[model samples]
Target: MIAIFGSGETSPAMTSVHQELIARVSDPQLNAVLLDTPFGFQENADEIATRTIAYFREHVGCEIRLASYRHGGRATALEFEQFLSRLGNANYVFAGPGSPTYALRHWHDGAVRERLRAKLRQGGCVAFASAAAIGLGAYALPVYEIYKVGADPSWTEGLDLLGEVGVRCAVIPHYDNREGGTHDTRFCYMGEPRLRLLESMLPEDVLILGVDEYTACIIDFEAQSVTVRGRGGVTVRRRGTDRRWQRTTFALSELSHPQVAPAAVPDSASGRPEPDGTDGSPMVEQAREWGAHGRDALDRRDVDGVVAAILETENVLNAWAADLVGTDERDRVRAEMRNLVVRLGDLVRGGGREGVREYVAPLIDVLLSLRGEARREQRFKDADRLRAILAQCGVEVQDTPSGTAWSLQSQN
Candidate 1:
């Protein structure tokens, strides 16, 4: 059985979903394993993992261990093998809330999918939610790149776990997102604009499997059944058309044979995940000169003064990231309290939140680390090469007193 949750994986709303899925586990002794790969790029990955474990321990009545596999490039051979073992050996596997592209980049290149396939094939529950759910399809959307970084609409090869089970389509979670309030953030934040563009780009054989927020679409391959549970329901969009299975429990066989709909009402209603709180160190709030302050670079030739205003934004981002994770600041603070998850919520929705600001600072430090190494070794050529690399990638690196900062120049 494959349980796909649209969102709210760790929220109180999802406790029943977790409990029910665990109940379905045939194993006498449940060994729940959490795949921490998707969100591994996060600086506070350890904290997230800890909170998740606690969530399971407290609410779900299951003690789950983390299978920490963050970056594929950074993992050793033994580390990769160990990751594979954790999935293969576990009866109930759960992964949620991370970058689809990041997880795809790591899993599709290796045997992670196969291990998952084997686990499902041999009969066990594998629940993947949110961003992880998006990767279980024939094609994957580069959500952050296209929606946030201003990249062109495109698709990347996915794990195709859905195709293995006879569903030829992309799995788009958060299908009913409305966090944008004033903007169209539906269709996984691609909006109708980019989504329509990308829909035309899909292969004829593939369709779209969209699950609504706070919903779970559980597929039982053996009995050939699909049960929709939660506040919202499932949506299976056919190629280039508006055909979909909006609500109600349906047969899994219906996927291979989608029928004509009688003017089905669209799935647009969405609910925000309940905030999970984390205690964070108090960060001094600063005045807003974000767009202007970052532009005061001393000189292009002055490497010491070179910085990116974006990184300063990222510092504020890092400070506030913890507050968003389990904290209900919306009741106290307003706009400023909106951290990474909420930022991620509506960031790609409107015309205003464009460029790479949507991605926060996933890879900025990696580039800075390389440049720092070059400068420490007095390798001026290598340091210059790093700058060129940033420039070519459309990142504008400028000077700041605290450190070097960067932002994405419009790729268009």
Candidate 2:
């Protein structure tokens, strides 16, 4: 199975898909590895590897090994063999966030591609997010080349990993990108106009698999079904017509049979309906309501309520992530989700602080009582020691006529 993430590799939005991929591995402790090929060109490539390792360990509850293939030819012969060994042994391999062309240059017709193919044959999961996802298609869009470097809008020869599964298509990540707020950069910074021109260059049999940002399409070979999990759906463009499926299950047969027209229902993205009678716009509206409920809970400082509300929204989002169309609507829902998460974090921290204070108050009272007894018994040394210990803890103990009052300096 290949899990292709649109974007947001290490972000909260991708948490669900990451976990899903991890779950696909039946191993009690998954031998997860990250390929540094994509970001290998960056000066801070090592830093990216380190951060991703920590993220998997801390967030995903799995330790990830780094499969460093920084350069195609720079490494020693022994080092190259070791890199291949590590990649071969990994049960779950992930590559994300960098230059597609650069990564492809190293992966194409190389040991990297062979090892990946072998791993898949052995039932290992290959998860590609963002740049890595873009490189697995029949045609690789040189995004930086054209968008940033001003090269002509063109399609480069991709790794074409999808060809193994009998699907001839170009994988376009960030399908619903809105980064260029003023202009149209929907197709990973290549606006629809340029994207159309690029599509014209493709052969008739090849289709366009446009995966929206923060979205993922998991292709399950065994089940022969493609599960779309993330903030957006998968867009299949055949001969200039796009058929998008979100938050819904579809057969793998749909990929090969491009002529099977989608049901006529107004889609939220383009206001065009699919051949299948299902429309996912209602799911989006439900998610929005949950987001509003979460915000309400946050406003009232209802910690449990906030958590419940957010979890409810997540349930809806995950259940309908494929159904979510309309870049604007998806963005709004995602923004609300992020805000909810942020505010929920704040609430948890605040509540934890108060909980700690409350918990310590009784312990402090017991200690004070023991110290009072010691003082009354003429155990001056013990009383002084207790006062000194409290002082060391930044707690001031005042022996007043009424009683001993203790206050934590941190509270002040």
Candidate 3:
């Protein structure tokens, strides 16, 4: 099974989807792993890993070990083997939120990519969100380079996992982006003009798989089905025509057999398709500037700064929300703004939540260690008190022949 998420991998908004996917494993002690290659270049890459681990533990109730193959060149032979071992063990693997190009650079022709392919071949689940999702196709958009750094629009050879599974397409996440509150920043920030140019660059048979932020398109090979889930829809674009699938199930076989309706090519004399009213919006442009600032604050771990930036963007959206509610472009911008706020909020909350998980897990470990010591010393009263205290706090301690294992009891 392949799960491609547009964004919000660890956010509360994605809780149901995560839970559903995790449930498919059918193993209470499933070996789940997180691939940190996507966010490997971030200054706080460790933070990203910790938060992702905590998200699985706290939100999904699945303890996910980190498969830290960030850079193969830096790894010892033993470390390389260990990383592969983890991937081999993992029944459910997840990667999210980083530079697609950077991840591609490290993952290119490596054991990590091969291991991922093997996992999918064996019917193990592969969940990719945001940048990782973008890297799963036949071609990846150089989102940051083209959008932020002002480079020419272009596509890079992706990991092509989908192609291996029979989907000849490029995955574009954050399809309904509105960070460019004034200009068109949709289509993973490429917008229509640049996206069309990039699309023209692709092989004619290759399709565009556009996943809106907060949405997912799950490709299940076993069932031969493609199901769209979440706040938005999945778009299949070919030759200037787009077919959107929303909250629906369709045969995966349809993807392999392309049935795109032909459209007349844009006249070479004019050079581009006519603009679809997605031009300049001063409010949207200002919102985009604030959105960038908010992202910077998140990277710096400045919670207050993130809140301020979100509020600044919110002010612009709130002021113009009414007027932009009707048009397709404006409505998408509003939706994008909403998603931006949620993502920024998740950054601050995820940091604090991960911190709590880190603190709590070790404290519980120490308590469990002491409980073992007290039991060994035959201090029944002390051991009982420790166990009771943990139980009172919703921690279930179980003793087995191997050792003591603990789980936070489910509140529900």
Best by TM-score: 2
1-412, model 1: which lDDT tens digit per residue? Answer: 8888887677655678789888878467787899988889988788778878888887778899888799989999999888888888888998887789999888865578888888778788889988888888889988888878998999998888887678988888877766555566677887665676787889888888888776789888887888888767777676545545444667887876677464233344422322223211122222123313433332222211223433444454443432222333222221232222222222223233334353435545655665787688898886787676666555578868987888766533
Off by over 4 Å in 1: 243-247, 262-412
Candidate 2 structure quality by residue, lDDT tens digits, 178-217: 5554566677887766776888889998888988777789
lDDT of 3: 0.75
Question: Model 2 has how many clashing residue pairs?
Answer: 12
**TM-score to native of every candidate shown:** 0.65, 0.66, 0.64
TM-score of candidate 3 on Cα atoms, chains taken together: 0.64
RMSD of 2: 12.7
| lDDT, model 2, position 346 | 56
lDDT order of candidates, top first = 3, 2, 1
Candidate 2, superposed: residue stretches over 4 Å from native:
259-412
Note the Cα lDDT for every prediction shown. Answer: 0.68, 0.74, 0.75
> What does the lDDT read for residue 265 in candidate 3?
37
Worst 10 residues of 1 by lDDT: 278-287
Clash count of each predicted structure: 12, 12, 5
- True-structure lDDT of candidate 1: 0.68
lDDT of 1 at 220: 84
